[model samples]
Target chain A: MNKMAGSSMGEDTIGAIQEGIRNSAARMLESGEIDVFIGYEDGTLPLRTTPVFITCPEDAERLVWSPICENSLTCYLPKFQGTVGVVVKGCDVRTLVNLILENQVSRDKVKIVGVPCKGIIDRDRVGKALGTDRIIRSAKATRRSLMLEGDGFEVEMEIQDVLAPSCEVCRYPVPVLFDVLVGNESMARDGKDPEAGYLEVAQFAELEPDARFSFFAQEIERCIQCYACRQACPLCYCPECFVDRQSPKWISRWRGLSDKILFHLGRVLHVAGRCVDCGACRRACPVGIDLRLLTKNMEKAAKDLFDYESGLDIGGVPLLATYRREDPDDFIL
Target chain B: MLKMAKTDLDAFVDALVKASYVVLGPIQEGEATKFGVVGGEEIKIPRLTTRPLKELFFPQDESLLSFDRSGTPDASVDTSGVLASDGISPRVALGVRPCDARALVLLDNVFASDDYRDPYYTLRREKTVIITFACPLPGVACFCESTGGGPYDETGSDILFVEVAGSYLVKAVSEKGKGLLQEVFPPCILHEADDEDIQAAAEARARGELPANAGVPIEAAAAILGHVDAFGDSAWEEVYKKCLGCAVCTYLCPTCHCFDIGDEVTGASGERIRNWDSCMFPLFTLHASGHNPRPSRKERFRQRVMHKFNYFVENNDCMACVGCGRCVENCPVNLDIRQVLTTFARRELA
Candidate 1:
């Protein structure tokens, strides 16, 4: 039975998805279908969730499905041993797909439990609404509404206002591939020009060159150089990242504007064709710097120039690896 | 020693600015609060700063000394002339919390030991004055009580400020603090702090108690870590699984002081600089002979736990952590150190 009372969940169906995930995880574990199952569990803090590694069948009860499940669990795949089962949302599935393509993980050695995601809630927006008094005791979410209760106060907010920016404009809501689907498929996205895809990148490109440079410089200057963005990314699986290499030190630890710009731009270039735009890097960043713009532009370039969208098929060659006779080389001169 | 109206705080800071002290205060940068050069504006002290005041002293990157090895590998390296002078400058850091202050004292044991004292750290330590605000409301993640520090702990602070009745009861904690206070504010500017002020300060301190479930078991932590064989335990596997091996936790932690030194060379003119390092990174323990002692995340996480609880306690007679909770609050995957400690303690008891 669902424990949530007066939740006003209505036709949200997250409850059904939650139930489905727990059942599937338990059955799989008991049958020895997978060695470990990775999913999200309720966090101690309100409006937050933590990634949980389930090894035993009984521990599957701890698994949860909620709008607060923001992390892309696929990042854990490369490090996992033996046959593993993982939970993935629409965007997270892209990471799994890319991981398989990159030979980071074998397709047959893993099982994917894909979830039809509406969107994950942004904790910052919730904090902003609650303001300085973060004494939130409990919070419940429905498809369209979220209700938070605490000492002497309760706030009911439209879910749209609190949805993560990446989730809000998410084109993929249904997982592209899943061994077992947990929830009903989300409604198909409205028809749009697939070739002209990088809307955010196009908007960023519209800025004048100087304005663009200043924009990047101003944004990156706030970076404390923690490298959480790199650590959180699935594509950044290099044993020794360029920033960490001291011999030919590509970047310094200085907080200078040039160092900051180089780190962000350099990272985008390194993961040029492979980046899946899961927004994990931006979400993991404590300073909330918009690191998505540059990477999104790179993704756009890969798409427009090569007519490629990554992780669509595991057998397809990587964008940078393949060569075409008709490939545009106008800048070669 | 003195009672200052809350409104007069800004004026006091401005006076410090006029006195040629580079006054640093908690400044709001996006979602986080950082200690930055005061802009003659109101200081918005958040529940706690994301990065501790340790950065001001130990710094993420500092030039120890640069050498000129221009000609050949065997050429005489000139140590006399350094690229950046490690000069001491007087500065006042305001609005720091007690937990962060205590962590600095713990750091002093490492950087300013009797055997070898770091000049760069010592110079900054001598020149700067730290004024801390008694924490009124410690967050859920904070565990200062367990780490042998409290909300109003004055272990490392020069002055402690307690807000009472829209005014501050400022107590000079050390000789340096008292002298600075006297030089900045005349006798006429301050009134005697009475019984009410002390009572109010106690109440403020009480409000910052460590949340019950999240309390650090200092004795249990030390006991579990005390046994060398405990390093081979299986509990670390669970603790490290959720960790992304990110530097965020160590970088944000108040007590983690591991650093890596390297040279930035450009056509023979280069400076050797020290930058923050984290045990969570695999490369932190990598050897030149392509052999890493602690190659996996499990060993790395275990090293972090042992270093804070066991190693630091053995070396300095104090736990390295002051429980500022920046790590707990900022870990992307939400790997709480409190949980790890509680699990270890419970397992040891069992």
Candidate 2:
């Protein structure tokens, strides 16, 4: 398990990508092409990266590119007023596309510097692999393996074993749209079959209806109603969420099972067509809820029934907004 | 001081259970570990629970009172049941870390204050006994020492337990703890502690007391934040940029005690409830006329920092934060509070 892959993209590729990002960001800021550049910087802890906003050319040097850059920077688009330069992974570009299509952000105002993603690391997976009890003092990442060190212990594991679940089934390793692209796109993992993306959803669908209901019920019970999932989602930009509305309240603030279910299901429906499966909601959830189960099913239904995929065709009308004669009406009854 | 063998933990827990105490400890729950009622399973003390210890005293949501308006147009609400401070059973919270224990004391200033007392919180506080496990290993995110707390600090714990060799050197910090020790540790039950055991316990505590990270000048930060002009500091603009306006930091915070009370009605019957609230949320400061004083994430994030450092210190003579580091570990965007504190600590005041 400790053996590193010899053929994987090495540190040289990552360094080149980082350099390219810094050069692009500095040039853009210097030329007045963008007012601000959003990217990742080394976080305080190991295997983590914090979002950094660079408004000056000199500050652009702080930008780093690695598997640890897990946050989708597109979520900040709605909050900005001027032209914004954003570093995006493959999945983040999809979110950016949705934002543009929804008119939440103007396509002209964004300078998208897209990076071909190998895969982002899941901290929870790494924690579980190295025993959660062990405190990781430091970490060093190579091309294919990560070496974690703690007091009296050191462990090395291949990067593939700790990739986020969403990355494993990712069909878009290369950004679908970008104004400027960094790194050799060929170095990224090959795109998987579209059907492969729905494997987990298919397995979940096999469960009995009661089992599915109980699964969600059990998962939602752990939710503390912190709304981290909602806040992390780029699509959930409503001025007032339905749950928070005082007048004609949809879900009460009480921590009841039904109220919790209403909030989760309500969110799933709100982002049904627009969700790009960026894994932000899952990563943001503090309780480790399997939010993708419900979301992926919605994505699959949109694919099977409406033959529509979100954030792909920028000119196409949203799945829910545009109604066609061929659209499935069987659920209406 | 007393000592008990590590192998005798089950018997000790059994003894506590037999004594009519409801024991709660850290239990492994799927991928996450949280504080729950100790059943037959062994209690493995993790560095920290997924959720903080505040939930045991202040739940996420709880019913305050129930009312019925079906009988008359103008009905009198019965609030007597809400504040009834009787019949609360004794509870023992086991394996609490010093940071979390210190947080309870911070919360006590809010919930059990001189001006007003929340009976619901006071009753639980009065009935429960806290048993803290002196930390032997602090995590990467932990900076409890920087926030006026230490690995072996006994601020709110009734009893403090330190692991030494194959046994635990237990020290009673309160009268209730001493009484309980007398009841549980009969002459035949506990081992007589010696100098070697005490030395080992001290070494273990020293290991944990070693700073996990460089200490931030929290006192200096609090002083700077106390300045009225600090509210308009440009640092707030940069510090809050990456914040997603999520309540993960506040809700997971053991010291944050803000709550919202609302009435839920179904036709003629209704129930009043209190739920945890966060300054990170926009709705927390929304005015009736829709004129929010804290209109954006910037103001909200600033309020969170100021409240913990300046306002709380000014009012209660203590900082509200215990530096448990849950916010640092769980922030989706990696907005570290330590960095924010460090920024204010080194800021130049006008």
Candidate 3:
């Protein structure tokens, strides 16, 4: 979405969406409509983006809007006492809409300042992009190209080449619901283009049943019992968890094969109809594991049987909890 | 005096709708009564609903915010939301069981806290007035009077309607009830309830489906919950061995309000999402640093009881549990909650 203005339609502020963000943050705070503004600030890594809670409009000057940012800060919205302002993209707007649908927070209480992102710098992909020698010092992108300035080196790469794998299948690249939108650019990558999941699902059948079981067994054996998957998910909220169910011990957090399978399997079930296919669990893993395959299998099963997809619509009921009288009786017999 | 016959349920519904209010009544959906958006004659009315009306105000699942791919969140306005933000529209909830009506009042100790104000709940609550029906017959799981409820406990209702022979014996309790009675006064009959009838009604309550034998004193039950750690005295392993961690029991329970929020991003933008969660899940209490406080279903099961009985009463003077029995009836393994509580109370198992 870098294609900025050059003509009468393109004001100087339209060069990068960052300028507009600065203006909006200044106005929102000046108007007293919001107490704090959540925006993007620099991370410890020069090229990475971290979500920043900007209470001062001057701090808005320190904020930078770019593709390197990835956070769903809707969880923080409920904890705010007074008026709060937030930044959102397409997927983030879906979460906001869901919250609104549930009546957890009023739309009037907060200000939504939106930005359309082109692609974010994938840390894993970038490590492979420049090989092991290059240390990324700083990076910025125009509408078309991302320039990475590293230690004793400079490199230019196509935005698509550095985007995260999940972004490759991203459908909504523009803001779905926003109050004030920045960067009037949009892309409808609804996967009319070549998608990855169909190929993976097709290839899974080619593997024999024994091979599949062995493959899962081998992969699960390496599980270190870390719950990076749970932490990354926006939906795994409980005051306490069951992996540690002391009363009956449904699943243990130990590194045993049974424990690992139980942990992952039980987790997938809890998110059965509720999971929105965000790929956060797969991305958050310290170990590179294809955790998406299990979730995607559940997704395929839900679609094939119940004709359901999570987070597709704001008003649609969550599939797992709600039941129709006509629901299949597969488990009944 | 005009007598509104039982077959005139159409007129009964029409009469409520013409009263210029969004009419809500008991609806028999699946095995629950939480669904309360019926205003026409197609509505089903039973002697009592399995669940309470609290779900109407504090729904099972509601959204706090929506996030986009860009990591920005936009809060929802209304998709023709069931109720308006302001208190108007004159809502009348008909056929609410007295137990469910009292459950609404019980829920208030938590919702009406001085600290956090749930605006959505408060809005619907103020605009709506309850019209409860006396439980002509309780179900297999009811013990309302044993726990300070009766065949007709009345607190949150505006109008209390008793189903008699040909017409309804309507008792106006609140000013809103008085106003509603005036609106429907044209077809009303002034039949004063006598002492013998009230006494006969009280006696008839015993023969009804209510189990006064549920075996927990309402007053001391909350006190017994103070010893959350007292589970050490029982065999908890036998209690939860077959538990599959499916979380269906917690999801179906009327008062289980735990939820989780997440984000789904497509490129530069993504949406943060919130969905219902259960302590039955292994990751519900998992920490980012790889440590979990309650790392097994057994401990999670223990927490469920402590939170409902001990922690809830410790904080809000009332138990979070309404004894809806959804957990008991819907368990995949047929694990009854009566057995669980009985085991905790050290009662003789059948």
Candidate 4:
């Protein structure tokens, strides 16, 4: 099994890190360095995780770091007032950094405890790999394989086959910025080209315009106007989304082809340069729409034209917020 | 009751199609099972469809009426060709879960009420027939039994199918179902269900085919929830704390029938359309005067629960939620409604 496929780095490595997290959180809470410790706890559903808020030192044991901790806990920072200790993974760190840069969250109010992420396993992918709709009672992950126990029997499967598409291409395995680090820094995989992030977008760009539209339309058609994609994203903290506005209604929340198409385009455009490529929106989508295609195109455009990477530096001018004289405008009429 | 082999279902669907009945059933798309027009593909059996059958009756969006001004300076309003009315054809929704079928009945309380009758919903309800499959073992998140729904509960379905040892035992719950079955399946294909078949079906339900009981004090919770004063209770703060206010739960809910009507105008000639709306949205209760009652997520979330449990029961003498568990499965934060109900139940007891 490929080691980069979001499997547990080893029970020992994870156990030590979890212990470190609990101890650190408890100390912070006890010392009053932080009023609230935000972390993930085991979710009610199998292969899922839920964000937990710990205020008391004794509650720090509720915090756990694992491959299933999929939520970007930093999203909760803006909703809070006091100094909050947040457990963040690689993508969440970038999101937190971006949130700080955007002034959505105050850096002084947040104490970031970064967890070394191989990658977070996609729950849907695991279900697909298991090839069953039965509820998994429990799942145990080893270094190379994942054992899923359910109604009748347990099946051991290779982790690589079940890693999320985003995880397969993730560049940051270790958090670049952290107040406290948990676990040893993970090595980036050598077989995959981390720098070639826009390969999928480039490949899709090669398709004919009609084919591309059809590809996008078919995916958007499945959207049920849940808005979970927008709600789950750390960047989408707008008090009023355009779709929700009434005075100059941008788009209707309809399942019609036109409405679906317009909503997708409008959302992608809104988050063009601000999105951190966190994969939270795609993961949150219940119908499994390929949202990355749109977001990745925007990411590629930001990199190629503006020479910008979001959340890369502290307090830097955002791509869309500040205009550079060297900005590429060849496509402009 | 009549017995038919599972293999003969395709022929039943073909016969229904031949009779010009729009057959809507589970269509397997990638890893998800969604409800759509049957296309000779293998019908995904038992699994609760991602898209509820309610969409068949109350569509996501449809034009209500069109206005034309180009013909004459004064606009000529046309109400004759409302989009849904043009094709008010008979439909058979097969492979529906019992909870989903029950949800339609719950929705009827509002749409087909004596006080205000929705012609659009009424017409669809009259034209459609529901064929439900007895839900198999419930998943971890299911609590159908607590919400007046069960594996074999057949309150709203025209026909109910229970999986027996080797064949499906079908029971007609309504006159429409009886006529449809006789028309679709020949006597030679259907065997009179023996006592053994009925017994086995009972045994399946007795073995707890559905998930564990919810144990929520529905009666007490409903009573407490119905009070206007209970709206300010502190329980709402904890219950709605995790909610991201995305409307995923409400959109997927089979019984949620609230809609927003608007006009899609195009150069002075346009069509008035109705689209699904969720109470979870901040704008759902917003007024033109900039005043809002359920302004915050906490209030919005409480409104959802109260509407489902208290308001619906007060109006219709029945709970609105059918407990299909779609909300539980798809909630982005895993904010289980079952937990909320249980919490309220505990509060009521306290």
* Predicted model with the maximum lDDT: 2
- Kindly report the docking quality category of candidate 2: medium
Model 2: how far residue A331 lies from native, Å: 2.9
Please give the lDDT score at residue B3 for candidate 1: 89
TM-scores, each model vs. reference: 0.92, 0.96, 0.46, 0.94
Tell me the spans in candidate 1 whose CA falls farther than 4 Å from its real position: A1-12, A132-138, A149-153, A187-197, A254-260, A331-333, B69-87, B186-189, B210-214
- lDDT digits (tens) for residues B111-147 of candidate 1: 9889779877877888899999987666667778787
Where does candidate 1 clash, by residue pair?
none
What is candidate 2's DockQ? 0.58
Candidate 2's residue-wise lDDT over A1-333, tens digit each? 111121233557777778889999999999999999999888888888888999999988788887878898899998799999999888888888888888899999999998988888898999989986898887767657788888799999898999998898888889888999998798688888868999889998999999989888889988888899999998888889988786777787786899999999999998998887889999999889989888888988898888877887767677888988877889876
Candidate ranking under DockQ, highest first, comes to 2, 1, 4, 3
DockQ of each: 0.48, 0.58, 0.01, 0.44
Over 4 Å off in model 2, which ranges? A1-11, B72-87, B186-188
What TM value does model 2 have?
0.96
Better of 1 and 2 by TM-score: 2
Query: What tens digits encode model 3's per-residue C-alpha lDDT throughout B1-350?
Result: 12234556556667767766777776644223444667665765665554446656765434433333343365333323324433457787887877667767766766667876666567778788888776675543444555456666676788876665544556788898788767764553344566655555456544543554345454454454455446563566556643445565566555666666554334654334344567876668987777888876678887787777778777777676665444543343334555566556653223
Clashes of each: 0, 0, 67, 0
Order the numbered candidates by TM-score, best leading. Answer: 2, 4, 1, 3
lDDT of each residue in B85-195, candidate 4, tens digit only: 644889898999888999888888888888988778888888888998987667666678878778788988999998877688999999999989887777766889999
